[model samples]
Target: MREIFIERRDRILRIAVKEKGQLYECFIEEEEERNEPLCGEIYKGRIKNIVPAISAVFVDIGHKRDAQMNMKKGRTYKQGDEVIVEVLTEQIGNKGAKVTEEYSVAGRYAVLTVNRQGLSVSRRIKDERIINNLKNELVLPNDVAVTIRTSAEDTDVLHVNKEIDSIYEKICDINEKSKYILKPQRVYGENSLLHKVLIDNINNQTSKIVVDSKDDYELIKKYIGDEDEIDVILHEDYRTMFDYYGIEREIVSLRHNTVNLKNGGQIVIDKTEALYAIDVNSSKNISHGNKFDTAKNTNMEAAYEIGKQVRLRNLSGMIIVDFIKMRDDKDKADVLNALRKAFYNDKTNTRIYPFTELDLVQISRRKKGKSIYSYIEEKCEACDGHGKRLKLSYIENLIRNEILRVEGENAINDFYIELSEHYEKSVKGDIFTFLKEIEGITKNIYLNFVPGIDSFKVEPLLFKKQVENLAKYKVNNIEFC
Candidate 1:
C-alpha cells in the first residue's frame, strides 16, 4: 500500500505520495484560488427533478454539479424533498453531478457518511476476523452509517466517537442555518485547505515535517496528533526546507508531460479542448527485452502511470489510451486489469471500456474547466479564447523544435513542414533561434500557408498535440499530415 504526506502553505495543501519508502507523487491544493475543488463537499439541497426513468433527481447543491440522485441507489425521497448529499463526482461541463444522499463530513480521524445504517470497513482491509470484531465492537447510531476510513485501522472508539459528535454538531448548526434559506444555497463547505489535507491524508511516509509558517505547522501538528499516534516535529525554517531538500526541482518535473516508469516505458499525456489521450511507449533504451517482452514491459508501466496521471492531473471526461499492442490475450487482460486497479483510489466515477478493434483502450473521465496544468500556464491573449496560437509565430516555434529534434539524425533525412502563414511566421522565427542554440542542426523546412480553415495542421500544433490529438472543429485536410 502507498502512503500519503501533507504540506499546507497558505490555503493550499500539498499531498505527497510515496510507495515502498520512496516519494512517488503529490497533489497540491490551491484553495485560495477560484479554481479550487469542492468535489466531495456535502451540503443541504432541494430537489429539482425526480426522473423516475433514470431514477435520478437533479439536486441544487451549493456550488456546482447540482447533485444527481439515482432513485434506487440511496435513501428514497420526493420531488420537493430537502436532503443532504455528498458530492460523488464533480460537474463535468454542462452535465450535472452524481450525488448520494448519504452525506459525509471527514475529519483527521474518521469520515461521517451520515443519515443511514451502520459502520462498514474498507474492502482492502485484510485480517477479516479482526475487521469483523472491530465492526461488531463499534456502536453505530441508529440513524447514521459510516465507512470507517482506511486510517482508522487500530484507532479507539473514544477518538472516533469524538469526531462523530463534533461533525454532528457542526452539521446540525449548518442545517439550522439552512432552514432560513427560502431556496437552496450552499451552506456547508470544505474546511481550510490545511485542515482538509490533514483530515483526508495522514503523514504515513515522510520522516520529517518542516514548516515555514508557525500557524501552518501548528495546524498540521494538531491534526496529526488528533488523527494518529505519530509525532510530527516542525522545522520552523521553510527556506531551509526548500533549499536543502529537492522539492523545488521535483515540483518542476511534475509540471511536464513526460513521466518515467519503474520498468521501462514512459507515459506521454496529451490533452485538448474536446478530449484527452495517453500514449504508452517503451523508451527503447530502457526496454526489458524481446519484442513481446518490450510490449508487455511498456504496457504494465503505462497501466500504472495512467492511473497516477488521471488523479494528479484531475483529468475528467473521455480518455483514450493507445497502448503498445500485445499478441497474447492474457497480456492484454493483465494490462487492462492493472489499469483498473490503479484507479481504485480515485473518488471520481470513471468508465473504462475494453480495447477497441484497433487495440485501443477507451477511458472517459468527466472534465469541465481548465485542467490542472493549464492553470499554471497563462494563455496567449492573442488566441482570442484559446491558449494556443494558430498565428505564424506559434506554429513556427513547433516547426523549429521538430527540425532541431531531427537534426543530424541518420533517419528522417527530410520532412515537409506544412503550416499556415499565420503559424509559419509566428513559429518560424523561434526555429531560427533554436537552430542557433544547437550548432550543426539544420535541415530543409517546408511551409504551407493556405487559408480556408487550416484546422488540420494548426489545431494539432495546439490542442491535438497536447495529448488527445483532439480538435474542437473537425479538420478535413489529410494533405497537411
Candidate 2:
C-alpha cells in the first residue's frame, strides 16, 4: 500500500512517502526558524539596474540582496519601473534569488500561465484521445494559457473543467488586484508544504495519509473535504511517525560516507565544493558467476542506490559517478540506461550524460535548498573539519624543544609542562625517557595534565623570593609560580 506520513518534531516538519513499505521520497521543512520558500511566490519588484552585457536585470524585492531576472528580447524597463515578478529559484550560497517576469500558478490538475496562450498537456500523459479531449474541454481566454497535468488523466471531465475554471478565476482576481498596488509587495505566496504534497500525490492509487499533528490533520481534512476514498488518519500512537515507519533510521544512514549494497558491494559518496564524486566498488568474493556479470550487477545496483541517496540527501549541482569497470560495450550501455530509468520519477530537473572517456558518468541537478548533511551536521572545530590531528610524537617533540629552550636559559631550577590527557597518556613512557636525558641539568621536571588541551604549555618555576614578590601569581593551580 502507498502511504504518506507527516510528523512535526521540535519545530521541524518531516514528510515521507512510502510505496509498499519502502521509503520512496522524503522532505523536511523548518517550521519556526526558516523563511518560507520563495519559489513560485509573486511579488511587485522595482528594477534597480540593467546589465546589458549579461542581458540580466537586478530588482529590489525587499530581500537583503536584490534578485536577478533574465531579460527577454523586445522587453524594456527603466531603472525605477515597478513590475510583477515570480521567484524562479531561491537564493543559494552567495547568489541572489532568480526571478522571472513570466509566472504560472499551479493547481492539482492544471497550471495557469499569465499573458500566454495555449493548452499544453503533461508530457508523461501519452494518450492522444485524452489530450485532445482535455484541450477541447478547457475554455480559457486568449491571453491566458493552461497546462493539463498528468493527474487529470483519470479525473472526471466536469471536475477537470471546474478546476481549470477555478484556477482561471484566481488568476483573474490577481490581475484585477495588481492595478491597485502602489509599492513593491508580495501578491501571492506558494502553497503550504502539506498542501503541495497532497496536491502532487493525491491520485487514484494514494491509499492513506497519516499525520501526527491534530491541527494539521484537520487542515488536511478541510482541504480534501469529501475525499472519503483516501483515508487521512490522525496517528495518536506514542511512537513518532518517522520512527514508526523506520524513516529516522534510513535518514540517519545517509549521513555515512559509504553505503553497502545487498550484493556485498559498496559505494562511497564524497561531496566537494565543485561536485559530488561517487565510487562504486565490488566485493572480492563474486556474487555473480563471471567478472563482467558481477561488475554489471554491481553497477546496476549502485545506479539505483545513487538515485535514492541523491534525493534522500537533497544533493544537487554537478555529480560524477565512477561505476565498476566492465569490458563489454553492452554492459556500459545497460548501466547508463539503468541510471536514467532510476531518476525518471525524480521531481527535480536532472540530466545524465553518457560515460565519458575516463569512464565517468556526469549528472547535473537543479539545486533548491541546503543538503541534508549541512542541515544536520556541523564542521568540527578541533581538526578544522579535516578529521585528523597532530601525532603524539610530534607533540612530544615540541614539548622536548620547549624544555631544552628553558634549560638553555640556565635560570630554571624546575619547570612544569602541561599536556592534554590524550598526549600525556600516550607519551608517558617517552616523557620519562626524555626526562632521564636531561636529568643532570634539571632533575625537577614536572609534568601536568590538562583536559582538552590540544597543544603543550610551558611555565618556568620561580624561586621563593620571586614568588613572594608576585603576590597574585599562580601556576598550574598552585599558589606559587
Candidate 3:
C-alpha cells in the first residue's frame, strides 16, 4: 500500500511517501518557499541588459538579483520592454534564477503554456487510445497550448478536463495581470506543497494520506474530496508523524554516503560537482553459489536502489553506476532491463544507457530544483566541504603546544582553557594527564567548557584570585585543577 505522511514543524513541511511501510520518497518545504514565489512562477519582467554575444538577456524580475534568460529565436526585445517570463530555476549561489520567455503553468494532469500553441502529450503515455482521447478532449483557448502529464494516462476525462480548465484559467489570470502590473513582479505561482504532493503522488495505489497538522489534514481532505477511495487521516500521536512512521530515520539515512541493501550488499553514492557516481559492492552474499550469479544479483539489487536513491536525493544531471562485473552477456542484459523497469514510473525524464565497455552504466536525468541535501543538510563549516574534521588528538596536541608557548613567556600560572562541552568530554581523559604533567609549571591550570564553542581556546589569567572568582558562579561546565 502507498501512503503519504505529512508533518509540519518549525515552519517547515516534510512529506514522506511510503510503499508497504518502506520509505519511497521524502520532500521538505520551507516556510519561505511555501509563501513566496520562487521557481515555477510566472512574472512580468523588464529587459535590463541584453548580451548579444551570449544570446542571453537579464531581466529585472523584482528579486534581489535580476534573472537570466536566453533570447528566444526571432524575438527582439529592447531595453525597458516588458516580457512575460517563467522561472525555470531558482537563484543559485552567485548566479541569478534562470527564466524562460515561454511561460507555462502546471496542474495535476496538464500544463497550460501561454507561449507555445499546440496540444502535446507526455511521451511516457504510450497507449494510442489514451493519447488520442487526451488530444481530442482537452479544450484550450486560441494561442494557448496544453501538455497532458503522464498522470493523466487512463484517468477520468472529467478529471483531466477539469484540471485543464483550472490551469487555463490560471494562465488567463497571469496574462491579464502582466498587462496592467507596471512593476516587475510575480503574477502567478504554483500551488502549495500539500497540493503538489497530492497531485503528483496520490494515485490509484495510494490507499492512505496521513498528516499531523490539523490545518493540513483539512486542506488535504478538502482537496481529495472527489476521491473517496483514499482515506485521509489526522495523526493524533504525541510523536511526530514522521517519527511514528519511521520516516525520520529514513531521512537521516539520506545524509550518509553508504546505503545497505537487504541482501548483505551495499551501494556507496558519491556526488561530485560534475556528476554522481554509485558503486555496488557485494558483501557477505554467500547465498548465491557462483561468482556470476552473485555479481548479477548484487547488480540487480543496486539497480533498483539507484533508481530510488536518485529520486529520493533528487540527484539530477549525469549519473554513472559501476556494478559488479559479470562475464555473461545475458546477465548484463538482465540487470539493464531491471534498471529500466525500476525507473519506468519516475516522473523525471530519466534515460538509462547501455553499459559501456568499461562496465559502467550511464544515466541522465532532467535537472529539477535543488537536491534533497540542499534542503536537509548544510556544509560543515569546520571541514569547508571536504567532509573531514581535525582529529581530537591533533586538537589536543595543538592546545598543548599553545600552552607551552605561553609557558615559555613566563606568563601567569592561573590559566584556563575554554572549549566546547562536547570537545571537552571527548578529550577529558587526556586533559587529566596534561594537567599532571604541567602541575609544577603552572600553579592552577583551569578548564572551562563553554556551551557553544567549536574548538579549544587557551588564555592566560593575571591572578589566581580571578580564576577562583569566575569558578564561583559555576555557570559553565568548568573543571578545576
1-481: candidate 2 lDDT, tens digit per residue = 6788988765567788887787777777765324533667777779999999999899888777788999888887799998778887878766778998877777788888885788788988999998888777767667777788888999877887788788778777777677788777677764356666777777777889999888888888887778888899888754456655677667656668898999889899998879999999996538778888899999999998999888778889999999988888899999999998889777788999999988999999987656777545544434456653344433444454455556666666566666665544444545455554334234455566678885567666677664444333232233221
Local distance difference test, per candidate? 0.60, 0.74, 0.77
Q: Tens digit of lDDT per residue, candidate 1, span 55-160? A: 6788876555566767855457667878767666555567766777766676654566666666777665676775876666665556666667665666665666
Tens digit per residue, CA lDDT, model 3, 1-481:
8999888775567889988888887777777665444667778999999998999899999877889999888988799999899887777677888899888877778877777788888888989998887777766667877788887885888888888787777777778878999999988764444566787887778899998888888888877878899999989864457656767667657778898988888999998989999999998777699888888889999899988888899888899999999888999999999999889878777999998999999999976567877765544444455653344533454455555556666755666777656555444556555554434233556666677675567777777577777664332344433
Measured against the true structure, the TM-scores of the candidates, in listed sequence, are 0.65, 0.76, 0.78
Candidate 2: give the clashing pairs. none
Which has the greatest TM-score? 3
* Model 1: number of backbone collisions: 26
Question: Which regions of candidate 3 are displaced past 4 Å?
Answer: 31-37, 388-481
Candidate 3 to truth, TM: 0.78
Q: Which stretches of candidate 1 lie over 4 Å from their true place?
A: 1-25, 29-37, 46-83, 90-100, 107-110, 156-170, 180-185, 190-193, 203-206, 226-244, 260-264, 285-289, 344-354, 363-370, 385-481
Error of model 2, residue 356, in angstroms: 1.1
